[model samples]
Target: MPTKSLTHPVRTRASRGDIAVLYTVHLDTSHPTTGCDVSPAAVHEEYVVTRVTSVAADGAVTSVQDTRWSYDNSSRSLQDIPGVAKIFVIPQDRVDVEAALATAGAHTYPDTTVLRPYATMDEVCDAINPHRH
Candidate 1:
């Protein structure tokens, strides 16, 4: 039998004609701390995908916009994946994220650090929305 993967879904604030659902998965990693017989440290990472579906009063889905993001444990922050920014849905939040990433230079992920921003949600939505119409 194959193992089953679990995902959690959260409802986002919706407008009169649409309902948004966010689905999340947690990823875990363990690495040895130091020295002989030292216990490993467990780290948790998150991946989130959201679907904003436009619906009619009869509960029919007319359109859907999906987006995704990943958490960077070393930076202790969320990072948007390329072409998927609406998963966060805020512009100022990205500014704060940049500041946090800058201050997190002291931290290393496997001896290196990398932080960058993906496209804005509006850009992503615009690119994909054309296909839906």
Candidate 2:
């Protein structure tokens, strides 16, 4: 699978009525591996960004910029989302994403639709790389 980090501009609206410019990105494994026996799809290493701005806009997000640091042996990418200046690692797998999102409870914007949160790298790795040992 080709691992890539996509950085996007962000605009954070803080609880303290503050707005900040930030850059964010989401780490994704285009082709996820799956099986049973050994630990599958685990991130052995990665090149990532650390620092970012809050400029999450409805614009097109392409490329990686405004970096800080990257986690070694990590498949997760550091994203800079709007409204927040914190670093977060997310899973791009559908199963992992859906499972993690269950914590959000319910979604109000989409009305009948429910929104979920991001998934941890471990969970994503396990799902993708089942076990083939």
In terms of lDDT, which candidate is strongest? Answer: 1
* Backbone clashes (count) for model 2: 30
lDDT of 1 by residue, 87-126 (tens): 3222221123233223323223455554222223233233
TM-score of 1: 0.20
Regions more than 4 Å wrong, model 2: 1-83, 106-133
Over 24-66, each residue of candidate 2 has an lDDT whose tens digit, in order, gives 2332356465564233344333212222222235421222222
The Cα error of candidate 1 at residue 113, in Å, is 16
Q: For candidate 1, what is the total of clashing residue pairs?
A: 0
List TM-scores for all candidates, in order.
0.20, 0.19
Q: After superposition, how far is residue 68 of candidate 2 from its true place, in Å?
A: 29
